[model samples]
Target: MSSPEPRAPRYLVRRWGQLLLGLLLYGIAISLMIRADIGLDPWTVFAQGVARQSGWSIGIVTIVVGAIVLLLWIPLKQRPGIGTVLNVLLVGLALDLGLAFVRTPEELWARILLFAGGLALLALATGLYLGARFGPGPRDGLMTGAHARFGWAIWKVRTGVEVTVLAIGWMLGGTVGVGTVAFALLIGPMVHWTVPRLRVPAAGDPPRPARRRSARAQAAPA
Candidate 1:
C-alpha cells in the first residue's frame, strides 16, 4: 500500500491569528492609499465612489459589495471559510476605522511615496494571510471558481474582473490616478515575491489519501 498524501494544516486559532495580522497590514495599506491621494484598489475604489455618491459610509458600501460577492460564491458551491468571510467584513471595517484617525497626505511627493508604500504593504498582507492556507478572499475565490468552471487561466480571469471593477469605479468617481496604474502593474509581482518568504511551515497535520493511479499509466507518461 502506498502512503497517503500530505494534507494541509487546519489550525483554527493559528489561521485566525494570521488573518488578524493580515487585516492589520491591509489597514495600513489602505491608509497609505488614502495618504497618497491616489486611487484605491478596484474594490475599494468602487466602495469609496459609491459611498460618495449615495451618501453612505464607505464601510456600508464595502459590506454591500462583499455581500454581493458572497452570494456569487453560493452558486459556485464554494463555502465561505473563516478567512473568506472575515476578509469581506474586516477589510471595510478596518478601512473605516483607520481612516478615522489617519490623514491624507498634503503634498504630491508625499502622496506618491505613500501610494507605493501602500501597495507594498498590501502585497505583504496578502502573502501572510494566504500563506495560512485557510481560504481565499471573495474576489480571489471568485477568480478560482471561474477558473475551475471555465478552465480559464486564473490570471486572465482576475485581470478581467479587476478591469471591470476599475471601469465601474472610475465611472462612479473613484480616483484612478498614477497610483492606480502603478498598483495594477506591480501588485502581482510583489505578492509572488513576498508569499514564499512569508509562508510558515504547515503545522499540526497528518497526511491525506493520495489519489490512486494506474502503474502502467504512470510508466507510460514519463
Candidate 2:
C-alpha cells in the first residue's frame, strides 16, 4: 500500500522533528557504544577504523563516509529526501557532541549497561527516523539500491557488505568482540518490533484493511 501524502503542515513539522531527534539519538547511541568499549556494528567499525587511520574523530569519518556513499546512489537511480541529507550532516555533529559530554565509565558493569542501553536506543532511533518516512539513511539506501539494480537477495547484500566492512575495520584496528555478534543477532528482531509501532500516522490516514499475501509474496522465502 502507498503511504499517505503529507498534506498537513503540522504533520510535516512532526515528521521533521521526529527525524531530527532520531538522528541525534542515533549519534548518542553510537557514542555510548564506543565509550562502553564494546564491539560496534559494521558501519561504525568501519568509521572507527578510518578515524584511527586518518587521525580524525569517528564522527568526521562517518560524515565523509556517508557523503561518499550518497554519491553512489546517483548511479542507482535512488532519490535522496531531505532526511537523507540531514542524516549525512547532523548525525556526525551529534556524535561529536555526544562524545564530548559522555565519558567512559571505569567499571565493567557500567560499561555493559552503556552497551545494552546503546543497543536498545539504536534500534528505537532507527524506527523513529525510518518511521518518519522521509527516506532511508545512506547506508540503507546503498543496500536497497544494490538489491534493486542486481536483483540480489536483501540478506545477501546486507551480510556481504557488513562482513566486508567488519573485516576491513578489524584489520584497521577496530574492536571486534561479543557485542558485534549480539548486535547482529538482536537488531533485526528489535527493529521489526519497533518500526511498525513507531511509524507516524499520515494526516487523515484511513484505517488499513487486513492484507492477504499475493501469490508471489507467499511463494517468497521467509
What would the per-residue lDDT of candidate 1 be over residues 124-171, giving only the tens digit for each residue?
Answer: 999878876768888888989888877899989888888888888889
Model 2 misplacement above 4 A: 1-6, 203-222
Candidate 2: residue 87 lDDT (0-100): 93
lDDT of 1 at 167: 85
Predicted structure with the largest lDDT when compared to the true one: 2
lDDT, residue 169, model 2: 92
What is the Å distance of residue 122 in model 1 from its true position? Answer: 0.7
lDDT of 1: 0.79
lDDT values, one for every candidate = 0.79, 0.90
Q: List the residue pairs that clash in candidate 1.
A: none
